[model samples]
Target chain A: MMDLTQPQWVKHVVFHPFEGFEDLRWKKGGTLKYTAVIIVALFFALIAFDRWCGFQFRPLPDAMFSVVPYIMKSVVYFFAWVLGNWAICTLLDGEGTMKNIAIYSSYALIPYIVEVYIQVFLSHILVRAEGVFFSTVYYVGIIWTVLLLFNAIKAVHQYSFTKTVVAIILTIAAMLVILFLAVLFLSLFQKVYVFFYSLYTEILYRLRV
Target chain B: MKNKSRRLLKQCAAAGLVCLLSFSAVSLPVSADEPYDVYNYNYLGEAVPSQAGYLAERSVSGLDLGTTALNAPSDLFKDKDDFFYLVDSGNNRILKIDSDFTQIVQEYKSFKMEDGSETTLKNPKGVFVSPDTGLMYIADNENARALIVNPDGTVFREITKPASTVYDQQLTFLPQKILCDNAGNVYIVLNNTTKGSAMFNADGEFIGYYGANSVAPTAEVIANHFWNAIASEDEKKYRSRSTPTAFDNFDIDTVKGFIYTSTSSGSTDTDIIKKVNPEGYNLFDYMSGYTWGDLFSTWYSGTSYKTKIVDVDIGDDGSINCLDSTTGRVFQYDKEADLLFIMGATGDQVGAFSQGNVTALETKGENCENIYVLDAGKGTVTVFGQTVFGEIVHEATALYNGGYYEEALGPWLEVLKRDGNYRRAYLGISSAYYNMGRYKESMEYAKKADASARYNRAFERYRSQWLREHLTQLLIGIVLIVIGIRLLKYVIRKQKNKKKHSEPAASGSGT
Candidate 1:
């Protein structure tokens, strides 16, 4: 609505699921500030799910707990999807920009992030036998987030239903390729750095001798 | 200051004395001279270093029992009278030793038959003193006969190869191990038979097979089964049928009469160890998914050594002690199939055994005080004495399994104070605390035990109690938070309205 504020728009889009992304695209851009908050919340949500969930529902960490994997799963993986989706959509004549894609993706992730925190809390209260309620709530959150994401991609790119599915599949493939290349790039850089460092050490040793 | 220091020194001496008294109070019958590197699998299936439950007290030969030196002893059995019947295969006789490891009670070398003929045992592989008939069931190995003889060298019944249609006519009845049940039914482990032990009725009649191992449902087996169902006669002829592994040795429970069998076949995973009831069904059907022997294999001398359980002996406390021929380790588990201790490994030392050989095992005393393992490679029986940690574990396990949780707590805690790596101690303590309604303490131990069911049982109670106590405060906190957010929103909106109204004139010159 023209009278609505930025924060109100967030609530409006979430409650109005199907038409939310469409309305936001027609009216104005989605808020980047809210998207940033959601991304950070995603990281915290993953950490809390792994570390703070009740002992009954979650496995005790087998080794020292590390935040690096959570960061890789949450933020890095999310950004990769954003980049991959944007790049694929460009070639497919999709109209969504990279920024818009990032915003909508983060907005769709809201349900999953909130669900993780709720599940963590519920785990403490429910016994092992009463895990049905916990799992039902968890799957509901996951399904809601996935549906929202599908809708967001469709609405943002102005695509039909089948076209959206195709685009989503291509985006996943692109994400994997991008991830592999990035790892390769990083490891190659590390090797090059090590090589120069060793050369330096060898020169120092020869000079000393 | 000098007076206070003097008092502190006196108090320290008293504390030291108290510590010394407690240490002596819990001193073990087994000394610190353990001859083997003992280990037990934890909850994670990792072999963690553990306190030796059985120390190698001493290794002795047949000469130690006032008999000739034993040669390649194959089987060892302790009867109700606390006498050991050692099957000296090399010596071709059965030597009955007294309870104290001191002297030979009787040497059964020859038996006067009912037909007025004197027959001597030739390479007897097994000897069982039947509690029901009070007779010696000797497996005359090389002679291909089972002799039911009295303890005084008088033979009662001699069983030879049966001429029955059910039995293969070409197969020789190489009776390797023999045992007679309460009803006088004799079950004999044949040297070459995959169809299970050859069962004989009280009248010495050839009965049907009993307790045959089922073929493991591996991927290939399942695939073959699927194909065979829809296969033609020609296709079926081409398909290979899976054969079940034969059990090599078995031990009957003294009290329950349940026969526990062990197969030395290391390739197949199923039916490695079993507890069969009188009805011919495995009592361990519920634990079929569990791996009874060492889950991991080791490498020695360029050959992969996997644990192949050659013999199984049920101890007095209903504990199952399995002897692994490849690793030469005794894997002892409680009645509930929970692994308690792993003792001995293959080496040239006094306690260690030589790998890749047949071994015999027997436990002596009420609580399995001494474990005797007859290593054929060295031709000696290594006697292992129970340690203090083992006593505590046994006491705790008995109480815990008996549902006496409160009483088990003390022993389990004492076990923890000795070996913190003992995973069962954590589970035992957790269960005890759970039964006592100490939910918080139960959760702490449950987490350490890596137990989800027990942890959840405790967490549910802890959460409810906390929620009940803080319900009103939680409500108040929620209400305050909602009110504060509403108030903050109202203030912000009002300030924005003022700015919007005032900025209308300056909107044309916006920055």
Candidate 2:
């Protein structure tokens, strides 16, 4: 509906994983702000799970005071995946754009984001012997999220399940290539900067002489 | 001028205080001034400086035997009679020194054989005195034989290399170390055999090799096994094969008769240390994958220096002392393989050993009051006497291992006071509190010790007790939360309905 709020739309899309993205697409799709907020919440959920989980269930060997790794895993990895999937889907004549890929993918991640907080809450109350329930909850959340992710990708790209799977594999390969290029760019930039700075220093030395 | 003088005095006092604080910080880790670096690996496998467990007393070399010094004593053993046996390999003799190191009780050089002929030992590397038979087992390295000599320097029996086809006829029998199990079965470590120690029965007839080290399951080894599985029989015969490193030295727990072996093939860390049973199976179960020696190797100019245990000695109190050849350090572990102390380092000082090698390790007295290390390069034995901290740690460890956890609480607390970084003390305290029915306190200490299993056990009981005490409150709290949420939902719906009625078109278009 036109009156559907952002959180309510996300909730509706989550419950209806199969045809959720189709309905969202019919309703002008999603915005970049919503995707960013979802990703930030995902980051926080992961941080809370690691930092506040009970000692019996491993609250990090040493409690991590820094959230840099969690931020990279959640926000940065999500963006990378979205960019990679978009690039692959575009070449495959897919209907999904970069924005739509990010939004749909983030919607799939709601299950995991919810599961982490619940597990974190239960970890403090439950003993290690009763971890079977905790583990079951985690597995259910992860499987549901993965199922949602597959369905979302399929619907957004308007492809068969097999084609969607192939696209995902290609997307992973694309992500690796992008990462390799990123490192290569960074190192080359450092070398160029060093070369220019050395030339400037030589010029200054000549002027001083 | 008088006020200025007072301010200057105050500045001087503050400056002196800062200096004092900085000096205290600098000297915090080193609790004592010693010749060598004494350290122990923490639970995270990082080496931290610790209070000395043993202080190197006097270096003994034939203390009261006048001009006759013990040259390159290869092995040191404390027999059941409390007498010390020193294998003077450089001198080509065995010296039976009294327990007090007061004088050389006896020396064995020229041995009268059963055939009424006399022979002298040539560079004997190992000696073990049996209390029951009153016989001495000596591994005469250069002579290529093991000798069973009587107390009066008479050769009771001589064991030469076996003529069995199982043992390669091409290789010479160069015995490096020898020992006898309670059944009078002799196990000799050959210098050139990876098949394991050559075993001989009571009558000195070769039985077979016993307790060989297994090859590490490395990637290359796994791949080799995979290929060997599919290889044809003819091809398998000519393929290069992987073999296990030879265990260099071993010791037996006189009480349990379990043979504990140490492999000096330093880089091949797998099976570097093992405690074997009578069935020839390695039974060391405590922290099975735990690295026994130094966690990190030091990189020199070209190569990394790793701790390769050349010798092992089982103490009377169930501790295992290992001697490293490269660093000349002694690593001592408790019965549970918890590192208790790390002593000795490479230096030319009296207490320090040479970097080239430290060949022997032995613990003495009823409670292991003194530890003796034979430095082959230095040619002197450095006696390490138990310090106060060590005595407390030993007592606490014994009581803890004996299941007298509650009694060990006091000593563990004392250890924590002396060194807060001692994780074992936290574990002991946690267990003590656990046995005393203080589960909450136990959980607190377990967290400090990083013992998740112990924390879980304690938390289980604590959680049950908590649930029982708060069941009624919990139910009420859940009911209240449900009602509160429902009420909030209704209030929000009412507000939304009012807003819809006020401006229906605007709300629908924007949302």
Candidate 3:
């Protein structure tokens, strides 16, 4: 039987992992400002990493880099922006100092980095596959799902580690919900953009400028 | 220094303004009563005087069942000794008091049967007094039968379904309420039928059936009684599956010469209640939607007041006190808006209380003087007098009823603001939202209601019986499909392994 009197293990296993590291302490009274800086730094770091990795693909420079690669990169960039925006606002809005907010923001991004590593590994193997489309689609699905699961955990903190791990196992569920809503919004925007763009193009044609 | 002082004064004023705003926000609930309309009745809170323009006199003289719960007793009956019997249904006992209610002259356990026999009464549902002979009638529902008793505690008769109706073990007769009329006739309202017998002058005799025929028995009656002729063939071919009668309970007003009964139809999926009168042959079912023509024509018009009733009683003076227990509220409609109060703070126990269920309602005196409520939960009789401001509050009954719902969204929402896990409050708020035409809000409330209702054993059983049977089959089909797929895959793999093994053996033998 576990000793009821000594509950240090739970404290160690759970709280300590998320506790502030030496460099992660509250930087100033302004938690929001700190979170913004950290997120801005993370975004730049991601861009740098993408650029470093971009050399290997080198999508024929002449062809405006295949639409697929640019589209995927853009999608990832948008998600990263969303993550940074939601996390900074949520974590730093109250008692969080900038440094404390940055710590939480950094912890949240761990899942994204891990997901990117997996994506890179899979791409290395499947870049030569017959149906490159299938591999890309599959990996994209995995990354999208991992990001949604991570975001949901950030949104709701009522569950324990076991429950959260179970939630991760059931990633497709949270993915379905977030993806459906995201798809719906994008489709609506696409229709509106198309309509407006056509109208502008027609007017420009008539003007013959 | 002057500029600094001016800035300080401005800052102080701004701080004071913020303080005032915060204080006002906190005080909103306490000040809610200031805007009370004369017609509005907020009885759920601590008893306060009704607003203005309703009852001029707050106290009733001589009748003091001190600390009693007669607010809306399920059933009321006056016996041979002129003693009014209030089924203090909440206290699980019958309170027998003199007409003026100055004293509780006698108290009887609801378990004592019609023949004065010792039989446990699970719940005393309704109380009735025969005007012809002053005999008392009590519907003891736990035992699932009606008991007739005399003023001296002698059980004259115990009414049950005729034995022939119980043949082949296909019987579903559950008695809910009873009513006695001036002509010495007794009517027992079952879950779906109003079966009764006309008694001879002062004697209990099975005279004949009254009101409508049974829904389940009509076809059987036709089958057995009709001959094997052309008529029989036509009857069998044209057998009608008309809907069952929807009465909830029955009430008789000897003075006014009318019988009142409440009927409800629909399953969990659908439900409706109707108030019906035998003499006028009138029925008021709210589910049919609002019929203004019927409302105008059927209302009891007085010199200055009119009442469109869903459930009502004719007082000794022929005044009506109708109950609208739907929406978890009992609205007392009167000429003066202040007199039109709302009761039943809790949604569970309502309407002439019979054990948490209000089964019947009656006014004690000729001027519609006192309203006696029979609450079956606490099993006590509650009496409420018309207050000077026309507000009526029954303290004990309110406590029991407060559990289901509060009177408004304000109290529930305040709790949610503090701690959201108070599940019952969510359900109550949901019902309030639904009543206010906020369907989306109602759906959210329903989710909470579902979560809380699942905790109740009876409700859980009901849901399982209603939904689980069909759902279980669908689940079983899905499981079978999964198992079938697994078995098919296993068989295919085994066959492939066998082929490989046989090929190796043949090749080795040839070598």
Candidate 4:
């Protein structure tokens, strides 16, 4: 018998040709895929703005979508959704056709749309005076939670109802584990961030001719 | 050697810096109340009793619970491993039911003696499964002996003791109603016609007998009258009672290592339920008069709430619910965080209780999502699903508003087990695990999350960043230490050179 423990390069190549292809397809999904891409771009944009300009948005931004920015946002969102969908498809099926890929993407987008509506509604009701831009932090939460639930349900359907219930249970459990890690990681980040910032500043000072 | 030292110092400084950055990146649940929620329950009205109490209508058609020829099934138990066991009392056998009560899938005849001869059993009154080993015991009414069945269906031994009493010529004495603690010690409750019950350990060693023909404690001396008020099935109102007699039942609190027997005595106006520890300790006494007027044939069941001493189930945060068998009322004990959520009393046809008697109760699953109720009279087991296990997450979010890292850890871990690749819980679990003193496990789960999303640049970015931060901390710390040391050495050498030059000049002047 083949040594099951050893890594079989030949077998892996033969078995997983489609794996890399799926990732490529996700990256190259046309204009329609721009929604996911735009979402991801907007996410990063928000985070970057928060870090650099300290211009953190909260509540719901009252500004309506302009043609160019809206298109840009759609592209970012398309990439983001593609990334999420690809992550799921690749993880579950290893490889999926673009047609199948779109179908799955739509399934996930249902919850995404719901989450967006929820954030908009909440922003209007709860933090309306603050303007929609101020509620970015809260909106991020709605997006994350709704996506998690939808993904879990989709996962269950792919696996089984039993698996879905079990998945839901395990998701709750994973929360506890992540909480612990976040604490540890957060504390480490604080000390390192300050130290690095100081070190970079000190080097700049000492290196002055 | 100096270069090596410098490298080591830089590594140390880098390590320290990387550690600091990652530490500040994530939020943790550090609040004291980060564990669980506490709610208080108040007294709701009485539980209604069905005139034609719960009967197996679907099976064997029209078999009434009250007047059915078949004996009332007894000994409802869920093994520690969550396997369900029920002693089909009239069948002279034990039925191992699945958690969902899907079928009477497996049956074990416990009445056989060691010799393979069928031991005569009038009734198998009580049953106990060893939590440690799953060994089963049945109290046979006809045989008048407690028979132990090996885990593999063979009769291990029939425990025969002098305390084993047969009912006076009528097969009245229930042979062995047994309860087992975690240590496999068994406490059998034998109903003696002359004396009430004789308690025994697993070794057939008799402990004591209490409350004979006239010695049974009166109902007035107990603590609360939750088991007092009797209600009709429609739950319209309470019925008045002249006198009531209390029946005793036994159960083992495996977690607490206590064997408890609930006892009650009845007077014309008062009804009481007293739960005594196996050591003949009257721990809690229910002596109050009934809130609702009692009926004549009110059957009461006394079970420890999730093995707690209090006749109620308490969440990790101290929420309490006391189940009153008589009134069918589940009282919310805490008024402040009053969560008197009424359930099982839902007026659904299939799920409704024919009688108000809830014989056994247990809180199962990670968050106690389901409550199991065994009504022997009903011949049915009903599960009440909590629509709000998700409520814990919501409430947890509210109290610990910001990323509740500590509180989130418990739920996140559960989520990971449910769905291994779930990222949100994975991210939550990974960070929580690290903070919760489980580093190695955190790595495994985090790696799973990362692996599941390998093609995603965001995950890769975070994962790589984490690794880079780790390595940089090591490298930078070493570099810093090395530079500091070299600077110190150069200064020292310079000072020595200056001293030597000054001394030489002094000598030349003397010459």
Candidate 5:
């Protein structure tokens, strides 16, 4: 008799991947506000993981200090995945709406956020030789997030395990196609802008003369 | 009036003569009286003008020895008796001068062959005197032969085009530089051959090519490999072949007998510098991804300029001094290939070269106290003597290389006093502090040096020590947290039970 819309239900969904997402799908357990907060928290966690982590674990160049890439990786990639999955699911006769799919995907990222915070804390205390322990926890968190994602997709779409896998693969392919189209469009616009700018410059030069 | 005009003309003539004499003296390019500044790079890899390193003592032009003004002196070799042999290639002669470079001991213009015929050199580029055999090996480049001369100026052996089946007959055997090992195995750097230096034995027989350059793994190479894998044999035959880069110059380390080669090509990055062992393998390839020369040219904007290493010289204390032709700078590294200092520049100053090619480098004295750089353009040899600061850095580097980290601490600190931007001093001091169990100070210095590995080691020790000192407190804190969590859970359950009972009663009464 627990309230399905409560923020605490995210913890339940993470621990009980098989039944928790199913209950969430049927009972409307996830809320948009809570999901948005979790996604934002994931973004901050990624920045902290990169910037404040131990030097041994941080592979990025120490000379550079930019967080825009981390933001694009977490926030932009998360939304892209949601949009890509939603676009794929429409063809597969998925029962979930785009809003529900986005909320579920964001809710599934809980384990990654928790693990990253723990890792950032542990990086200060652990040495290079003990990096294996940190890596294990880090990888386990990713695996847990992936499993929760699978469960969320399966429950929301009301699809079998194999069907969910196929849909996820199709979603990845669609994301690549979208990225290609985006790049093509940007380059085409750049060429058109250059052509117009040159025309305008020629006109300006003639007027000055 | 006529007598006064005649006296004015005589005075003008005298002044003109004095001006002409002074101009000729200044135009000579070899000035012994003018002091020259020597520079070394600091820790930040910036070329800072320092006080303790080499100063241009004197530039030996070999003009005083009554030679044709050392027309394009290509190579300089100091023999065991401290006699300097200048390979005056343009004059087709080798000038043997004394160590002080003031007196010519002997001049070898032509040598007597075994058949008693006099054979003169034609554009000989390199010369090396063997300490073990007391013989001279000269690279007769234009003649396409290497002459091994005896101490009495007789041609002991002549190494010409090899007739061996392994030696490609089509490839020209133009010897540019030559060196001999302690075992009398001759290594000749050919101008046209890319299969590495042609190796010869003591009997002047061509054994085979040794230490061939490895092709770089560029994008084109990878693409070619991919296409070749799927292409038919006919198509594969039409494909362009990948050729290895040829070495331009080389020098032999007398103690270890390791032949180090330098390629002056600006096009390729692979094998710009290499240390070849006796078995013809590049031992320096396992430097763990360390680049041999300057990673990026400071002069270029937005693009990186690769180093063109024209010559390499192993110093007396096993330091590798690589002469870069592109930047006209000498990058000196220790035995382990750690960059110690970057000296020389392309300018008209004392420590700089003027549009001239640095043909050769030689280190003299017990600890390589003096460095001689032969400039081909100016036809002069610049002698750089170590300054006090340079001496301290060298001493510290030697001690550090010899595994006397604790002993190197004093000199390393003294080096820091002279040059605060000296990265090597910071590294040396950190290592010394690390060995002395001063982990905190070691970490600080390591951070300053940007030596992350050393800093991590020190941090590990510091962290463990801190953990050990606070272990009891940490355990007590953990126990208190566990108890507090359990009590909180117990209180929450009791409150929930009470609420459940009251809610059920209230619901029953409402019904």
Candidate 6:
């Protein structure tokens, strides 16, 4: 049998969510490098979905490309959820480590990445009238990803279903708090920089006098 | 660093001078070489160089006709006899000029009432001549009344504020423009009424308001509704109330008797142009998805400036000419509301308006050969006569709009010969070919025009034709492929059985 502790075991875990994640936890199969690669791939897939989708599905034909928001949405959001869940898990006496949570969460995103690439390819072939078919596939992919995520969290943390639900809600709340602080930090930095720059300008004026 | 800064300043000055020179060059009046610069958007919505449908023939000021200078002429009306009526609002008089605009036929400053008393107009803003009765109707704006007078200057009727309980008594009755139908039912555009124009009977009796503008549902309106649902009565009292926009000007379609109204405000996007039926419902409401005016402002970035339609004129051929005061351009639409042409601009040149509002627009001649635009600021009426290129386009458009697709094909092709970038010509030619049962050619033209809907229709027909032509060959090929696949499978199965038997026998012998 193929070794369950290999990095390639993530594929088996994603396909067989109930059994595969339980085996991954027992075998210590998940790896941080694989998860980081998956996150980067998902980001590229998202950019491709936006730029190369059919005109019928592309809402903003004249939309400009901005990479900063994409990075925030994919990479920063992934880390936020992992860290948030890790903090909540510690209080709840969950068994998962931070690395385990990151690997499991990234593995759960496999379905979404595959779905987006498929959508990008199908968009070129299908017209507006056949949009229902494309949307059904898209929605199924998202639901499958969500189910995988639930199973991953449950198996990695070794928590009951109810505890997993509460843990997810707390993690979402933590994400919001983290986002608020990030915005606050940016604004405070701006104000401080402005204040110091004005002081420098005033000192230069006095020296010139 | 100091030398570099000085160089930068010199470069900036040079650039500014170049900009000023280019602007002045554009502002210079039309010379013989460059008669007029005209353009129109093609099918792809890209502006392309095209012929000016109309050339500025001459500007007729009241002074040129030996009459008092037209002071802020707010309106112009063309009677059935082709006589021009200028509402000299600032002068408080109506100057009637002949079709040639050279001679003043008559000037009516006051009318004789039934009591033999003289009732003079005060800042009259609008004048209309009834084709049915051959009488004149003047909107006495300052006096807040409309006077119906005979051709001989005798007051037939004077309509003042309606005394009905339905009429809001608090609102002032300032009539700015007036028009009459063949049935003699009068419509008066009031200055301050958001409820729409006030209608009156032939005998000067008050009727209810007609065709009020509807408010556009913006985000603020939705938010206000949400707040109002939960707000206390005392809190609601302090909240601002939403009101509909008012119609600025209107004209009657003599043939269909439909009233066309234009609102000139830039703030509201809803009901900028409306065609009102006699039942007081806007016929243009059916066109909910279409936008009237410039899709995007050419001057402003990331902001859409709605067309401020100040005046609308319906031609004999069922074309609607909307005069946009903001851009000082006339957007002409056919009966189906397809834009046919856009002319004029805001500038100091002869073909443009100089800080002057395009107060009124009128079309003359059997085919609407002449277009007259009155500039209130310049106190001049600039006449535009159709060019040869314009004539061809109008001829083609008239035929196409009239549902003569086959007949319009020749003229549309002729238009393409003159200007290959004309998108309308491509669409027209494609439609003509489609109706002529030439789907392939139609698809080519539709593709050129970037009209996907038309291209899809043509493609459907073309695909069916191709299928029909190759149906027999396709059926034969399918049958042959199926037979070949079955034979190959049988042969492969036989070969596999033989190989299995041979392998088993060889293994037994080896053992």
Query: Per-residue lDDT for A122-147 in model 4, tens only?
Result: 43223223444535645665575455
Q: DockQ numbers for every candidate?
A: 0.49, 0.52, 0.01, 0.01, 0.24, 0.09
Q: Cα miss at B26, model 4 (Å)? A: 46
Candidate 1 regions off by >4 Å?
A: B1-32, B225-239, B464-511
Compare candidates 4 and 6 on lDDT and give the better one.
Answer: 6
Specify the poorest-scoring 10-residue window by lDDT in model 2 chain B. Answer: B61-70
Q: For candidate 1, what is the DockQ-based docking class?
A: acceptable
Better of 2 and 5 by lDDT: 2
Writing each residue's lDDT as its tens digit, candidate 6 over B1-511 gives 9999999999999999999999998854322422345666655565666656677777888889898788889999999889999998888899888898787988888899999999888999888999899989999999989999999999999999999988999998989999998899999999888988898988888888888998788999888888988999999999876788899899888888889999987778878889998787888888744456666665668755556889999988888888888777888777777776778877767667854377999988766788889899988888878778778988999899888999999999999997787788999999999999898899788868767667767766776787799999989999999999999999999998898887876534421
DockQ-superior candidate, 2 or 3: 2
lDDT of 2 by residue, A96-124 (tens): 98878988999899899889989999998
lDDT of candidate 1 over B1-511, digit per residue (tens): 9999999999999999999999987663233465565677778888777787878878888778777788888999999988988888998888888887667888888899998899998888888989876898989988999999986678889999999999999999889999988888999999788888999998999997888888988999899888999999999999988788899999999788889999999778778888998777787887633568799887869988888999999998899999999878898988888898888878887778988664799998767888999998888888888889988898898899888998999999999998888998999999898888788999999999898888888888888878988999999999999999999999999998898898877645532
Please state the i-RMS of candidate 5: 5.8
Pick by DockQ: 1 or 6, better one: 1
Model 2: colliding residue pairs? none
The DockQ-derived docking category for candidate 4 is incorrect
Q: DockQ for the candidate 1 complex?
A: 0.49
> B207-264 in candidate 4: lDDT tens per residue?
5554222333445433223334444445423533332242346555455554444433
State which candidate has the highest DockQ: 2
Model 4 CA lDDT for position A29 = 26
The lDDT per prediction is 0.87, 0.86, 0.46, 0.46, 0.83, 0.84
**Candidate 3 TM-score versus the reference:** 0.36
List the candidates' TM-scores in order. 0.90, 0.86, 0.36, 0.36, 0.79, 0.71
Find the candidate with the highest TM-score and give its number. 1
